[model samples]
Target chain A: MRLWRWIVCLMPGLLSAGEWSGYAELQGRYFPQDAAYENQSDHLISLAFQPEYYQRWDKGNQSLLVVPFFRWDSEDKERTHADIRELIWTYAGNRWEAQAGIGKVFWGVTEALHLVDTINQTDLVENPDGEQKLGQPLIKLSLERDWGILDFYTLIGFRERTFPGEEGRLRSHPPVDQDHAEYESDREERHLDFALRWSHYIGDWDIGLAHFNGTSRDPLFIPRISNRGEIKLMPYYEQMRQTSLDLQATKGDWLWKLEAIHRSIDSGSYNAATGGFEYTLVGIADTDMDLGLLGEYLYDDRGDEATTPFQNDIFVGFRLTANDVDGSELLAGVIKDMDESSWMFNLEASRRIGSDWKTSAQIRLWSDIAEQDPLYSMRRDDYAELTLTRFF
Target chain B: MKLSLILATLLLTPAVTLAMTAEERGLEIAKEVDSRDTGFHDFKASMTMLLKNRHGEESLRDMRNQTLEVEGDGDKTLVVFDEPRDVKGTALLSFSHKVGDDDQWLYLPALKRVKRIASRNKSGPFMGSEFAYEDISSQEVEKYTYKFIEESEHDGIASYLVERYPVDPNSGYTRQQMWVDKARYIPIKIDYYDRKNVLLKTLVFRGYQQYLDQYWRADEMFMENHQTGKSTLLTWKQYDFRSGLTDADFNKNSLKRAR
Candidate 1:
């Protein structure tokens, strides 16, 4: 706490002049069904604070941004964490650009799954949706041409993915023992990585192609007996190579998206793809609300051997936008297994309460889990959550 | 004898314009308007939007706008939000075209992501205000067909009333009536008619200002909805032109870095 205060106090002087902005959120979760594992809680509460500082100079050609995040969970020790989300300095030239420091980058265009998004590790303890990510240290360079934009990155350090603790509401059958993690590379977390991407747009289509060679962001877990003779999941990281393609086309009220990836490990290789479309009916029933229907198909060649549950699945969703002063929106989706009877359903709604405050609610339900399914452990973890945020 | 006839014909063209069809006269007037606004190059401004409901409760939104003129095409524009703290640092980028749908992308600061949005919602409200997407986009001469209704007076100034029909079938309004100032060839007022051919809204332009001694821009735009009893007022300031903005400043990368 003293260190945070010192940095906040000295930032204004060290940076000359900068602006501060961010938010504080309070979240509460309640589980309706019984816990799927022992030592789990049925209710949980958390508070998170993220503050950002930004400054620009040299006619907006150069700038620096800093974002630090901290959270406290009432039930899980692993969920109580703090980290820097972004601390990057950028320089924009006429045709070339450079950036250095820890930052976050997202690269994919799909609704059901993110097959091509592998720049940063997921911060899963924060949310089950896998949308939150940890910051990565890197140096990047970009060139802008008439044809497209090309980017090169040299990733410096690696960050491990976070999982729910034993006392957390959502967890695998056997809790993960992060302290006893193993890595295939001798250098372990110090493994260096590299990536390159080219993106362009033509008429109504936007396209991106990328390649990454380094430590895989997704880890394979192996069950092991710990020192106390208790069974725990141990994560193993392996080095791999991946090439991906993402495409999106916007035509009238319809948006078509696709993401495909081919990854090769030391032993074998696999392929995965997700493709979908979202069509909106504007001004439905003489009102200003928009109703959008989304459908996506997910496929993985590994089938039963895949670590993910989306080997052969389909997702259908609805998105409603009120377009009112409060910026109201709702999204509900269902993901069903094609081979099994397992399914997952989720609903999320949010709206601004006033000028600075916003409220959101989410519900997740799982049903009819098969023993071979990856999500069988979570069949009893149905939960509902509410969050209120105040922004500065 | 040939030279004398050519001279006579040239002299009669200006006065005998009444002999031309209404469509021809309207197209000529539109051409004049477009010609007068040719060389702006680029511009930047700050705008404040005031939205009021039927109950007279008001809300405010503040944003900054930048525009770059494209030769033989429509303009490129970027709008970044500043006020209403929750939406700060959010931005929208658009590439308008003359004959097809405009391409648009929205930047969400919280997620640090840029999403390509469908631009077919031309009649939807912008920022919960009475202004629709089409009302704020770049006006190209090819987007509409016009007919001259009459030459009359508006607010003590000489004006020409022209009726224009949208070329795109997806447009919400069937037609719009515009009053062009005689001296400046700028729009002074516009009445939007719904698909049912009924007057739905009226927009009045006030506080006209000229920049670079050639471009005329309105400082205030007031729009009122007749059936809903709602209104929106837009006030603009700090109009800077020729700011040297290039294509590099309006791309996906730029949208992510917008502050």
Candidate 2:
């Protein structure tokens, strides 16, 4: 393929003029509960590699970037995959800039729910947290002016969200069928998506307004009978429109943040919002450590039967930063459903090992999740994970 | 009675007229330092940071900084991390003021979000460096109250020793002692004491270079934390002044586009 030739020809140039950098990580997760499936294992190991290449010219006014990521999980077949994280060429003028290629975009302010972030497809197989993403191809333009900055996006080919395999520990039972995917759009994945945002800062407040219209990245799974006479959840992508507002106010040690959105899908239209504040206590106990207290309220209009979670929920958490040489920090939080006793608790900690190495660990727990809850399937998937990474 | 009254008046008047209050001398020196650093307009420079741990392990980070001087107030600055693949695309925008709360924003590349960091007390370290957030900011004359300590000599350079107290209640340090060079009106060394009045760190500036025939910049700055046995060294290069940078170049949207 011509792509292979391009890769071969670009190798030498990338080593000399362009910068090549990446990281490799080995991770392991252990579960306290017994294996839930025949092929499931209590212990799992995964190795991941991410390599990036970047080249810039004209005093950094123009550039090209390429980043490829791969992960190989020993226990779960679906977890082993490869993706192009970013391969964008960018240009910047005096007052405007443009980029065309595959990349990722994120928008949100809340810590618990990220109600506004919807650019890239979620790589659920990589982690249940959904912070990782598969890059999307798009053309982006941004204009900077006196009052604010305006950004425009033209999204092209869409990437479908990935799911954990049957053997994966954090997955729904019986698995969701990926091959029988259907889309409301006649063109399926070829459907175009568009988005725009205007952001500004006034005094101590930073605000952003954004809108998106496209094939919904979040699919609706319908229980269907397959050709093999087995029941499976069929993935259905629908057309949807969403508008969001994100706001944050920083005064002294307090950060007040809010993110709200209104989404309209063929199923119906709904409004959801999450707002919170974080108060930080710096130099606590006469040391350089900082402790941040966070509280947020989540609301949704659809109520109990709503497909979206976080209907009448509250999140409380704390983030502790050591301010050490390694940049060590720990964050712990719990989101409690007000309608029920269901709660999801998570803990994350990371620190540097040496000059080029870093280590991190995470723990997640779900308790009293009702059958109607969106996270009901993951109720028993409590896990503790550890990863050591090396960068070049 | 008349003789005694005249004697007392003469003694008191001489003492009052001869003795300069520490506050007066302190303000005079601070004014001099500010005067020498004025009218820079803007600047761009590259820096290499060396971080060392208690065990003597070392790490390096490369970065570029651009600062636009705002008249009548503080300066607007931007720092872009260039090395260390993890933080390459990371940029920090700061709008510093002499009084009141300064504004700061951090752009996280991996998350693709510009987070407005809480800037109540800037006592936190700047990216795990020995320099705290407050230390990296441009020093304005109004940020601290100063008192002349004494004159001292370091490395054979005549210097004026002064002690400054932070005006904000949120400062992590109780006081700081600075040694300013007599010839250049520049701080050559400083000692920071913690809230407990304990010696915390000492910073030294070396390799002073003058640019634009009027501006003075240091080629290297070293900060040593006495309590933690850690240190950070910043080596600056390519000092370019009057780069035609404007206020629009330091906005939040340009944070993501920073190279």
Q: Rate residue A24 of model 2 by lDDT.
A: 94
DockQ of each: 0.75, 0.51
Query: In candidate 2, which residue ranges exceed 4 Å CA deviation?
Result: A1-16, B1-21, B53-55, B82-85, B150-152
Task: Give the per-residue lDDT digits (tens) of candidate 2, residues A1-392.
Answer: 99999678545545558877878999999888876555777878999999888897666677788999999998998999999999997877788888899988888888998889988999989988889999999999999887788989999978888998778888775678867789999999999999999988898999999999998988988888878876778889999999999999987889999999999999989999999999999878877799999999999998996776699999999999998767789999999999987999999999877557889999999899987888877777899999999988
Best by DockQ: 1
TM-score for chain B of all predictions: 0.96, 0.91
Compared with the true structure, what per-residue lDDT tens digits does model 1 show for residues B111-137?
Answer: 777889999999889988899999989
Query: Which lDDT values do the candidates have, in the order given?
Result: 0.91, 0.88
Query: What proportion of the true contacts does each candidate reproduce?
Result: 0.67, 0.65
True contacts kept of 1: 0.67
DockQ-derived CAPRI band for the predicted complex in model 2: medium
